[model samples]
Every structure is written in structure tokens, then in C-alpha cells.
Target: MSAYSQQPALLDPLPLSPPKKEDELPVALQDIVTAAITEEVLGTVLERHVQAHKPKEPRVVALTADSISIYYLQPVREYWYLPLKQTHTIRIAPLLPVLPVDASETETAKWVAEIKDRITRFTETKDAPVDRFIPPNHWGDWSGVAVFMGFTLLIAAYLLGVGVVEQFVFTTERRFNIAVAVHCGVLIKRSKDVNEMKDLLDKHWSGDSKGRYLWVITSWIEGWRAVSRLRREIARLNLLIAAAEEETAKGTKKESKKKR
Candidate 1:
């Protein structure tokens, strides 16, 4: 006979045993299955749920006025970027409100304690990027060329102003934008700087900065305020979620006990 079979041969079918009730799924699993079925009947968002759970690669992140970048630094550098025309919410840790403290309260000796309560009621948000737009804090405040057009006497004044701004400026003259970034309402990067990170985008990205200026001023004005609020609101929501999860766990335990 050839190796390939053409005739139907004969083997008796194996007897199948009936499923056992004891071998059935647990009560919790049953409940979950029921809920899932109800959801599917009502038109489930299974696609979005699957997409949300898909694994993501580890990469470095950088942001700019126009786009956010995700890139690999080693193993042959590669980049992935998302363009921005919409406002994104981020939490700024560097801008947390500062409280006045006593220096002598610690083991380390200090002759004087800082009593600046007025510093607590700051009118401007802390660690904001527009801080760079303020005079003295403004860029090229050193460029003297950028600011005063390099007039001989103005140069001296600019240099002196720089010293004053550095040595004597209050806590309000924040000159950087370092924060945790969130996209699509999901927090991604823990520590990042929108102002400083843009240099990387400029270097590696070939995209034009075309539509940036249109919303630049308006967005910059609102940027820090949104971050500050988002930070607080996120913290508040976290507490609520934790409480809900705890309550759910308690209810589940009670149901299991009742079933037993």
C-alpha cells in the first residue's frame, strides 16, 4: 500500500463522558461571565478594551510645542511621535506649592528660620514656562542683544539685572516646565520638561514648526493652570477609586460567605 491513505479505515469512536456539575466554574467566575455576556448583547467595547491592554514597548519620551516623541536611544535609535493640535493634561510635580519652614527645627543647626508667609500666597503659578517671557527672567536677558539690542550702557544694566533676578527674585519667577505628561487622559512619563525636552525634538525630528505659533501664546498662558488643577483632581480621584475598590472587595467576601 502507498504511504498516502485513500480508503476510509475503521476505528471505533471513543465514548465521551458527560460534564460534571462539581467541575463547573466558581460563583465569581459565573457572575463575571454573565456580566460579560450582558455587555456583549448591548454592543460591547471589546476592541477598545483589547487595545488598552495591548503591551507597550519601553522608550524615552520628549515633548515639544507641536508634538510628543517616543524613541529608543540604544540598539539603533528609532523614534515614534504623535502630533499635537489639542491641549494635553499633565501633572507638574516641580511646581508643588512651597510652605515656609523652620531651619532650627531640625538636627542641623540654623540661626534663623524662614518666616515668609507671603510667599505662600503667590499670584503666579510655580515652575511655569511663561516665566521665561518675563523681563529679567526672559531669555537673552543675558543676550542683552535679544533684549536691549546690545546698547553699550544697557548691557551693563542687563548684567546687573541678571544678578538681581538670580540672587533676589522671589519663588514666583519659575523659568522651566518640568512635569509628568498625560495623553488621552492617561499619565505616561513621570518626570519630563516641555521646555527642555523640545531641543531633542528639534534635533531628531524633521517636521516643520508650521502651525505652532497660532496657539502658542494662548496655550502657554493656560498650560500651567491646567497642570496644577489636573494634579489636584487626579489625586482626589485616586482616593475615591481606592475607596470604591475596597468596598467592592468587602461586598465580594460577604457574597462568598453567604454562598458557603
Candidate 2:
């Protein structure tokens, strides 16, 4: 026989063992399996969860390793990311394109304590009206009382001014004034002032400003346009972050399996 034919087949099937009871799988293992399948279906969403678990990578540059091993018992690294393709695994020398440092044990402990404290406060404060938005407490009830008193005072003032003074007080005028005041307040808060706006345009607006009218007109246009652009950019970044999270989760699962 030829040497190749004499060699045992690498593809030889292994003996099958009987299935174990459902409860035989450890709870942690079950959770891992569930997460992996979920990540497969979710696609992009896995990244967000992965990010939540990942350590903070300090360097801007990518760090590649032949293989990367993260212990389940240790919180040494943030998380181990694995790729989605079943055919390939980072078992040999996993390339860590990015290596992030996790928070120190002391920092993690402090954060956990703070979070627990906040949660405890929230739970304890739940029954108290002082902590609630529409609490049944005295303070909450006072808001309603104040609102009623305000309307009463307003009506009394209007009656005194209109009936006693014989001044024309149209109902529409009051409504229009209120609406204008509310809308104007919102706009004022949303809008940047002239000088600040001008400075913003000068700092970031990349366009020509040749003449006096052109400079003023361009500055105004560019500033508002820049604000709108910035808003859109922020929204785009949020979407990209969401997508990245999904990939990271899938990667983590593969990393876990490779360890096994």
C-alpha cells in the first residue's frame, strides 16, 4: 500500500455518545450557547453587548497575537472576541487587532459598590412620594395646588383689569401671548447668539466669505448648516456603534469555543 493510503484518515468520524439529560448542561454553558445562537440571529446587535463586556483598549493601534486566551474565571481582559465563520477559529495564534485594558480590581469594586448603592436607594425610595414624579406626597400635591392657585390668580387679575378697568381682554390674546412666550423661550435656548454663532462659523465653517454682506450671510448659513451636519454625524456614529457591538459578541463566542 502507498504511504498516503496506509495513513489513517483525518476525517474519520468519532464514536457518538448518548445525549445527556437537558439539566446535565451547566447553567453557565447553557447561557453561553443561548448567547451564541442569539448573536448569530441578531447579527449587528451582538456588538453592543460585546462592547459592554469588553475591556478598555488604551492604544489606537491594533495588537495582533497568534492566539488569545481569556479565562472565564478571571476578569483580566474585558472580553474575548471571536469571529463568526465556523470554518475558521483563532485557536492557533489569535490576532488581537485591538487589545484593551480592563479597569483595575479596585476600580471595578468601587464601581460595583456605587451601582449597588444607587440600586438600593432606588428600591428603598420606591414607596416614598418624594422620589416619584407624581408622588402622593405633600410636595407633589402642592404642585397641583400651585397650578390651581395660579389659574385662579390669573383669572382674578384679568377680571380686575378687564371688568373694573373697562379694558378689552380677548381670550385669544391671552392664548396667543402664552403660546408665543413658550415657543420663543424654546427657540432662544436652542439657537446660538450672534457673536457665539459667528465664532462657531469662523472656527468650523469651511467656505469663502469675500464681501461684507457675503461674510455675514455666509457665516449665518454655515453656522446653522454646521449644527445640522453635526447632529447627523452623531446619529451616524450611533448606528455604526450599534453595528460594531453585534460583531463583537459573535467574535466573543467563537473565542470561548476555541478555548474549549
Candidate 3:
């Protein structure tokens, strides 16, 4: 026998437990099992069912070790995931949920405690990324400077009776248009690249506020174009109506003369 054989045969290593199947998971977590498996982060999922808002629909939330995903099943089926590494803030309400009528007071308290403890542990262990807040400028930035210069130029032009300057600068609508144009021009000139503009907007606005502002600006531009097109169409229609009326009048006069 070889030297290795002389020693007692090593016992077979303890077999590792097999991973849990999707069917074995709790009912609340069954829907997200496929998504979790695809992401390869399907370790353990803790779920809670609660109403998202008072008047809105309820949602299911699955909390993993590294991520929290919310599932909305009404009006539409949607899944949203927020990774622990990317989230910056987590706020839990004091009275998070209303327990079922069948649940005892003690059982309800215990359930709420457990949920809060789990969330607290996960957050303490996996901290979200820190945000760097950029201080906003006072009144000496490029935007401010551009606005001041544009206002001064508008006033000077109005005083000198420049072409349509009084009409544009004195009226509320035209003044608003001029201000919007100047501000947009300044923003474009100040931003060296697309990334810079995005960063600047992110620094100033949080969540969907930035997107909302962009949407409003885009809608305004599109609305202006639509209004202009409608005006042109109306003018063309009016001219056609006038020409038809003139032709009808001429035809009536010719018919009356032939009758005489």
C-alpha cells in the first residue's frame, strides 16, 4: 500500500445543501424568483405586502441582502429594483402597516418589530452611496451675467426706438419670451458637454424633478410649433373662403345681367 493509503481514508466531505427551488419559496416571493435567478442574486428574499399609498394601489416588496424590489400588480405589472450600493436614503414610517383584523395585537406588534429589525440590520450592514452636494451659486454666475446684459440691451434698444424693441420689451408675453430665450442661450453656452449639463441638473434637482423640467421645456417647444402650424392653416382656410365668396358674387351678378 502507498504511504497515502497507510493513513485512514479521509471521510467524504459533508455534502453541501442544494439551493431551494422556486416552488419552495414563499408565495409572496414567487413572482420575483425568475428575476432574481436571472440576476443571479437569489440568495434569500424577505417580502412584505402593504399598500403603497392611501388612495393608490397596494404593492409587494422583496428585500434581498443587496437589493429591494417593489412589484406593482394592479393596472399594470411592473418591477422596480433598488440596489443597496446605489440608494442614498431609506425612510421607514413609524406606523408602516395596518395589521389584518384576524391578527392579535401581540402578533401584529411582533411582526412589525421583526420587519423593522430586518430592515435596520440590512441598512447598517450595507450602507448606501453618499451624495456630494454642490453649493448653489449666488448672483454672479454666467446665467445671472447673461440675464443682466440682455435686460440692459433690451432697455437701451427700447430707449433708442430700435426695430420693434418697444413692442417686445414692454409687453408681458414678449418679455417672458425674451427672458426664456436668454436663459436657454446662457445654459447652452455654459455647458461644455452633455455630461456637464446632466451633472449640473442632477446637482440642482433630485429624483424625477429634473426629468419633469425637461419634459415641460420640450412640451413648450412642441406646443409653440403646433400653434404656429395651426395659425398658418387657419390663414390659408380664410383666404380660400374669401376667394369662394368673391367667385359666387361674380357668378350672381353675371346671372342677373343675363336675366335683364
Scored by lDDT, the top model is 3
Per-residue error for 96 in candidate 3, Å, reads: 18
- lDDT (Cα, tens digit) per residue for candidate 2, span 1-260: 22322333332111212223441233543343333322222221211212223322211111122211111211243234333211111111112222224656566445435433322222222111011011122454346445444544555566566553225443666664674566456346335533544543454334334422343432233333333333222223333333344466669999999999
Pairs that collide, model 3: none
lDDT of 3 by residue, 1-260 (tens): 22212333131111212223331334543343333232111111111111122112212243332233433222222234222221111122121343454877587556546554433433222211112221212343335445545765776676576767756555665775676677567546443334333433343333255453552342233322222222222222322333344466669999999999
- The local distance difference test score of each candidate is 0.26, 0.32, 0.36
Q: Which 10 residues in a row give candidate 1 its minimum summed lDDT?
A: 111-120
Q: Per-residue error at 187 for model 2, in Å?
A: 3.5
Candidate 1 error regions (>4 Å): 1-219
Ranking by lDDT: 3, 2, 1
Write one digit per residue (lDDT tens) for candidate 1, span 38-94.
322212111111111111321212222211122211122222332221112222111
- Model 3 — TM-score against the truth? 0.20
TM-score-wise, the better of 2 and 3 is: 2
- Model 3 misplaced regions, further than 4 Å: 1-27, 30-55, 72-117, 120-260
Give the number of the best model, judged by TM-score.
2
